[model samples]
Target: MGLRGRWGGRAAIALCVGAGVWLLVTALRDGWGRADPVASVFGSVAGLAALVLALRAIPAPRPPVPRPVPPEVPEWWVDRDEADAVVRAVRRRTRRWRSGGSVAITAGLHGAGGFGKTTLAKYVAAQRSVQRRFPGGVHLVTIGRDVRGPAAVAAKVAEETRLITGDTVETGSDPERAGNHLGSLLAQRPRTLLVIDDVWEHEQLAPFLRGAPHSCVRLVTTRKT
Candidate 1:
């Protein structure tokens, strides 16, 4: 609560407490009146109200901020027109989020083996323009080409989240539910780009999904078309 709110709550408690005491004093001075059947009950409620107000005056602790690391800019970035194209697409999507315009939730690179898909994805994330678009920071988590169950996926989400933010995510064996929980965590960080690289199946990306279609975009690099 702000200064005004804390003082306002204190005032309310004082008023309620005073009102209750006044009622009791009035009953004692004038015997039990016909309409004064609930003097004790009203006083008890006033005490409870004061307690609640006091609790409300104290603010809750804030969650720890994530410490994200963007991919290091390549020392000698070579001729990769493909990498620039992907960066432009991501820039467009992030702009839509900034403009309050509708945008797709997921976008990334996909290509055959030895085609530099991971390189392009990392390059895009390392770009200055892309980094600026995603103020929350770009977090890269690689899910290599292999089959993984729901539990495995959830564990990955928790591990990466903890690594990036030091916030522990409660993940279950269910990918859908776990995704929702992780998504809520990511939702706290709007405009973040979560890159899940070397994906084999769509299910591999499920654990990283946000509960709502908010500003956080899930970018994946895959061999699949």
Candidate 2:
């Protein structure tokens, strides 16, 4: 069926032909001159038929198919071994956290942004179990940029998450409306994780996060206490 298979099939036929010719020569040389001609011909035919059948029955090589797209595996934080264990734990605990509880992970060389917070958060988001927890898909937004205000942040998150915010959002919609729309979107999805990276202060981002649940865990990477 494939290139390799075709080549193999041709090679097998060549080998069978060579073997049949060698046997015929051997039979003639080893006193087949005294044997019955009809029986000799029938025997040769039967042997060749069986050899061909056996060769044809041999398995053919199948062509390799393209690989499936893998779910994102995050950049490792700390040692690779440690990250694997932590990611497994995070994946396991999403259900518990979404049930109105919280789970906090503090690792790496320091607290907040220095502690590989973003890396771990991404790992959690990418986990198969974690992805299942949020049907709407996890959204990661970096704050403290030019997009500082609540409205700007909402619009940015909506756009980043590929949520359909009408064209009017880019033209003149206020930040509150954008925030409200984002909140509504989160509400529609039963469980979601929104990581607000590099938060200068919790209060600054809180307004935009109003409709999102406590169950909808927010991973914050910040220097502030």
Candidate 3:
């Protein structure tokens, strides 16, 4: 119930309880004697009725709201502890103070192919705690080996931006320009987590890394050392 209704209910309950107590006291003073037998009986009954009304005026408790749950990992995945450790390290790094304010926290997972680096990145991003910090959401984009051209990389970045924001993006053959555009979109969202997967070279990553804002944390996965 609303504030007014709640107060109103409480007031009514108090009034009923007071009335019941007064009636009971008066009935007890009469002692159910012949002096006023009818009044004593009537007061006792009215007291009980008022008490019942008081009890009925109490409000029922509301049910508890459920908390948000993280998405479950794949059944075949077994590196849960590694994913959790990555999450902790990322969070700890984010909490550290930076002179220029919140600095860009870019976490890289580099290893040979088939080592589950991308899988761990996904698992870490899907965590409920990570989502709480990065409410803008974790946007993942794959920059595979074939996507080396400026136009292709730009298109991939724009496509990923469009996928997440649902807003139309205008991109060109300039990789830096496209990354800057995507960065602007990410900045609009508070504490965004951008996962650029399967990065192959410095040329492929520099644009995205340079353009991303301090609020956006980059989790890049690359097979190349």
Candidate 4:
């Protein structure tokens, strides 16, 4: 029931309990010789009924448990050996950079629109190996046609990451500032994977490219090389 209903029910229960107590007390005050057995029995029943009502009126509240966030990847992905090969190659390249002590590594999957570049990037980002490498998290950001300039892209990334709660970073208009805020949040972790999908131009990717630590790896999917 809603809060109002629950409170109303409790109030009614309290009245019933008070009435029952009064009835029991009055019955006990009267002498047995002058008391009506029916009245006494009714009083006893009322007291019992009050006890039951009080028990049902209040309930213990339970604490909520937070659920784990699910990965952003396609279900029922069909087998594409060629696409898988490219994902593996990119993964290896990122791993090599990490081993070589590179601060940050950026790789791109460039191809025409219909060739499934975004799909391939998703597949790579969702891979078990990639998940293991980036313990911080794997975030995917799509650059739509309307998402012009770096600041807008940074805002989208901030919204997707949810690094800061409330109006901080996400509501900002400055792309450079938003990117710096996002980078600072990501830098707290040892490593993270950022998947930029359907990027049309280099400028669209520039703002987000800043602030990421060397351990962070960026995988971009675009039509441009």
Candidate maximizing TM-score: 1
Best by lDDT: 1
Model 1 stretches with alpha carbons more than 4 Å out = 1-22, 25-60
| Residue pair clashes in candidate 3 | none
Q: Each candidate's root-mean-square deviation in Å?
A: 6.6, 17.9, 14.4, 12.0
lDDT of candidate 4 over 1-225, digit per residue (tens):
557557656766676666566566666887544355645666566667656655666665534322224355677777677667766665665567648755335777888878977777777776777777666666677885678765667667667546322224344767666767777766765576778888887767776787755656778888888
User: In candidate 3, what are the lDDT values of residues 79-167, reduced to their tens digit?
Assistant: 65668778987665556634465654678889999999888987887777887876666677778898878888777766776775665
Clash counts for the predictions, in order: 0, 1, 0, 3
The whole-model lDDT of each prediction reads 0.76, 0.55, 0.70, 0.66
After TM-score superposition, the amount by which residue 19's alpha carbon in candidate 3 deviates from its true location, in angstroms, is 70
1-225: candidate 1 lDDT, tens digit per residue = 689568869777786878677787877887778327666666677767777777777777767675466788677767587877788877777767667877778886778988978777888888888888888788888888554877787777777777655667576677777777777777776577778899888888876766646757778888887
Error of model 1, residue 54, in angstroms: 3.4
Question: In candidate 2, what are the lDDT values of residues 62-181, reduced to their tens digit?
Answer: 343222122365444344465566556544446555475655532221155456666666666666766676554556666664666656665665564343222233422355555665
Candidate 1, position 216, lDDT = 79
> What is the TM-score (0 to 1) of candidate 1?
0.73
What is the RMSD of candidate 3? 14.4
Which candidate would rank higher by TM-score, 3 or 4?
3
